[model samples]
Target: WNKLPLAVQTTESLAGSNLWDVPTSHLHPSTNFSSKLFWEPQCQTQLRHLQDRTRITATIPPRLDGHWVSSRCEVRAGPEFLTRSYIFYPTRLFKAFQHYYCDSNCHVPAYSLIIQGKLRLRQASWITHGATEAEHNLQKVTLVIHNQWAAHRLETRLPSSCLRLGSGVQLVPSKLYELFNAKAKRDCLGALHFSMMELDLLRLEIQYHPLHQPSKELFLGDVHTDQNQRAHYRPTGYQQPLQNTMHHIHPCPVCALMYQSSEQSPPILPPSWSIPLNLNGHWISQRCEARPAVLFLTRLFVFNEEHHTWEGTYHHYSDPMCNHRTFTLVASGHYARMEPSSKVQGATELVFKVIRAKVTMFEQTMLQMLNSSEEGSCGQAGGWEPGAEQDITWTAGCGMLGILLPHKEYELFKMEKDHKNRSLLLIGERPTDGSSPDRPVKRPTSFQTPMVQCSPDTAVPQHYSSRSDVSTGPEVSSAIIHHSVFSIFLIVN
Candidate 1:
């Protein structure tokens, strides 16, 4: 290990110490422990496989707890390796609920809103009966789903659980609008609004949005069907009972009715590397016994939420007469076409390319923002004293949204203004997408000991504890909120 690349070896043994009460790391050319390590040729094979990209599709197998399980495959130069990775399905996550299978690869945007002011809804929950003035104030009602991936897309509505002021009396729609329009208090809002809301609210208004894509479009299909089929499935015609979870533009019920009445058939799959191999899709999965099951060699049908129907796709592998083709309805109603090994390989490549492109764009955007901020500061008359000015650029991928850029060799992020001391996470920038544009870089500066104050949202008693805690009752037009110092600071600074 010591004789290998310096960076690789250093990463391998970062836990041990060479001296008392202190840890030590050796350089690549260092001979201190060269003789102690032995290199193995067999390990190289496994390492190479680890570096290759493997694609896994989420599926429900009857053999398991119905949670999502993934079947992954990777093609190597010498031999092919197929593996099964366990995944937690979205539907199974909820208690006693049938969850919709969302496309893991699809970029679903989400956002969250934190209420910094007094919550009138808290008291409104007590009104479980008749329609009253509070129930009529629709403008004050705000129901936003806080999906972390996309924060900008928010839906204004009332949660079902909200206690109505009166039975059969609906709250005024205007109140819902006021809730979201409420001022940003202490920047405490970091919430998620799911993709479903974006599609339903904006599909008619905007040309395209994420939720508008039918589940079938993302499922097994050709390029033409994938691009244009979303329109065939309309939200207005769906028969499925509309619910918060059913925010996805639904499929046509007429098609679903036809599918329900049609004869059931088994899925025909492409060739498999070996016997007993498993194949799967976003919502379906199949396992073959001996010579890749012939049942999987033909056509398979999948449920389309957009058109409220079922659609079938044909899958084939070369074998002359195609005698290997056979269809088996292992499970009634839900079926997936057996995918060709070659097609699977192609899908994996496309997924990787999309992810890489998005990441690259994120990095570039962050760098530009950081550099622009610094340039604006440097353009000032004093130009910045040497070493007195500092800039740090960084990226935050977890707990927060959006990719961050490097600032002064370090990345920075502003946390949700809440109980946690509003400190920033500083991480150094590594290689991202490509080279960043040059800018007037600022030098690092020492900060005199600065006192940290608790943010207003955090200083006050914690309001939201869990998803269940959200109010579902009579509407409260507005809340009386104390002025948060941070809110003032953010505006003034």
Candidate 2:
């Protein structure tokens, strides 16, 4: 806590009192999120096992007993789009509402699940530091189908054993009906192959604002990404975060609308955006993003409408808040014609290629590590210096950094606008397991967080370009090459 700001220290210290009891994985000088040790798939399970040996039950923080609402539509591994609204009682009784949607932006309502249970806080998590471990038991489960379309969609997923899917599904428009009740012993979850156990794992993150309102974010256990592995897998990561209602100030006004409209009926979510006629502009991440494998990053992209060319700059950091710089990956390429996605209703599909790749080391340690790598593995034999950009397109990608040089990726894109009228670019979700979406069958069904386009569109030199395997878009202004002045120009400044 001492490493955080004074505001965080004042409030968070009062909540826990004992700073030593909390897990601070990245706070130590020796801890490096950039290292291979931190991102390994088995590292999370290993940390949990070690922490469980010395586990001790702790009291649930008083501030946790309140209403929490989703700040945005969340995408799970099953590519499920949903919104979560939950309340925690002082008596340890909990009620959670999950509103499912057909589209990634949550415009099309599907159905809703109401889950009531008893939650017990157990211990601190060693994996997602500053989070607590908890267990829960389901008392009741209620499913409310929103419309005929939603009912039809659910019916397709039900196994043959669950023949009760059709009886109560036929309904009038603009009405909600209970399709399944725990008291009825429908065995719907077993038949549908779904589990609500993802709710038991909990993490509370407090964002402090000394001058104004401070807010807390709730991170539930992540749902298994693979549909088949979901039933038995315990969540290791987290889904999208939720903002609290009572002890609240998350800066997103929609959070309140979600809580209010969730009372009687499903809220008609406003500001539903579509792909713009022209996507030629500069788009940047609105905030620092935390992803799987303990990686934290922010992306900046420049697109030219006249040429249909795109350049993406990825800035990687070691800290959760994007305060500590580690390295930068520069990928430049062009996209082909975007066809309407057959799988996802509103998303557009295209292919992105990385004609050239460059890496820039931000720390002296990173430079030394790259210089020590075997010849042609990371880059050239020597001369690796911090801030000096080096081309790694020939060796495919920087081996030391674990970056892959896939020939092309089937990317999905959607254009959206926020309530504030800011243009947003939504890209396909990269596989969390560190695999490339090179094949058509591997195209993403869900989208990542929307990137806000820079207002008035900043101007950058148009030289960097990546060539797609199947060229279908407008002709390029220049030939695609690995070594170009544009690549250096983009990374240096």
Candidate 3:
């Protein structure tokens, strides 16, 4: 009880914090690459056995000769909220547009960058496993300020010469400057020497539909999660995917507007993490997701909108194929939904308080480790056993496992639908540092892996509340979301 520094504190309970330098987060989803069908990790051994039965065919690199637009607002390592629109030419030359926003979701307009470069598709990905590695050469970058407010916000980045053109005052939106000309006017666009969007290590993948219809996806190198190492860290993973406009089968109405958008006449692209009108339902991971920690996991969340209470279960695995069993963390909490964010339009802000949590062990290693712990240290010490679920609330959660009980998190949630109009939960990106966001200032601005909604028909226990005794078993049938087969939870509304 003495150690809970962030306990009982609401997001509104504190104030006076510095603004984020850049909300670029390393919260990214790992892929189960096969014909570009992306899914997260699934229930362990179950998914592993599916992978063992899977037969992979040689992959062909997708042609980079069309328009590609971000399906939704994308958040990178800095946890920066932005959108990308690109046009690739047959000659290998390309023009890319990056729209940066001010808030958590891409509601508030900041500025945009029109970048011209060249891309060359190369060998298969050595780092991304099944992805095709590629290279891109920087050519030029143009800055476009949305309005006076945008210019003022970006004033520090512009050189004095950019502000005064032959006179002492000039309109920033009207005049354009070379962000990285390498010849002149270097000071006009220094967004912390932002990795030029970190296009260095490139990978191109494709999403395959039922009829073998392939939608191209381009994955750029992930920027360093640490702000200090961002400018120099070589990308090993990928950022949020950009979809080829001509090929993408979209459920998003904004997809068309995205194709029509440009820096000069940019469309008001809505938040990809849109919040659903109704929240009384079950949301489960449609696919097992890969974590930067090399852990495969899935999450099941049930929310009672009227009561503002929620329950969540996390299934973690040890292998890439998710065949190895790990421990499960079950948590319950209450959420306070706030009004729309002034900083990010259409984005809902909320605070989630974790009232209790339980831990379930599935393997002997976990049992042995917990059994060897000192008395009253980690979950009742010697009482831990295989396949046993224990309440970690008394000890304020397992310190070794990073689970803090009676905890509160300043979380951001947004929702979107797929081609079939299935709901997806796009929650705030977890911090790269693995710490809970206890303050409103520390709340995430961007999203991580999306959770698919379970149809209302999916049976939810009537007794479910913010209580204990949650069943730790498969909630859905087996399905092929990846090249690897993983158990998925999905039902019709």
Better of 2 and 3 by lDDT: 2
Ranked by lDDT from best down, the candidates are 2, 3, 1
Q: Is candidate 2 or candidate 3 better by TM-score?
A: 2
The digit string of per-residue lDDT tens for model 1 on 1-493 reads: 2322222111001222311111120011211111011112222232222222221111111111221111112111111121111121333221111111112111121211112111110110011110001111111223323232222222223332232335554433212222332343211112221111101110000012245642211111001111122322212111111111222224322222212221111111123222221111111111111111111112222222222222222222111111221111111111122232332121211000000001111122222332344333312222222212222111111111121221111111111111232321111111111121122121111110111221111111211111111112222221100011111101000
Model 3 lDDT vs. the true structure? Answer: 0.56
TM-score of 1: 0.15
Candidate that scores best on TM-score: 2
How should the candidates be ordered by TM-score, best one leading? Answer: 2, 3, 1
Instruction: Point out the worst 10-residue segment of candidate 3 by lDDT.
Output: 19-28
Question: lDDT tens string, model 2, 81-163?
Answer: 77888888988899888888877667777777777778876555443333456777777766677777876766676543454
Model 3: how far is 277 from its true place, Å?
A: 5.5
Worst 10 residues of 1 by lDDT: 349-358
- Runs with alpha carbons beyond 4 Å of true place in candidate 1: 1-154, 157-493
By lDDT, who's the top model here? 2
For residues 1-493, write the lDDT of model 3, one tens digit per residue.
Answer: 1222221111101122211011111000221111111122222232332334132121224455788788766665455677888888989898988888766556666788888878776544333333345667677788788778878767655665643446555447746756765455344444545654356555454444556566666666655555666666655445666777876754656568788877876657654545554556667654345443223566666667756766666665543233344556666667888766554445577888876667777655456766887776668998987656788777876655555567777766766666576777777665444455778887766566676666442223332212112223222111111111111111100
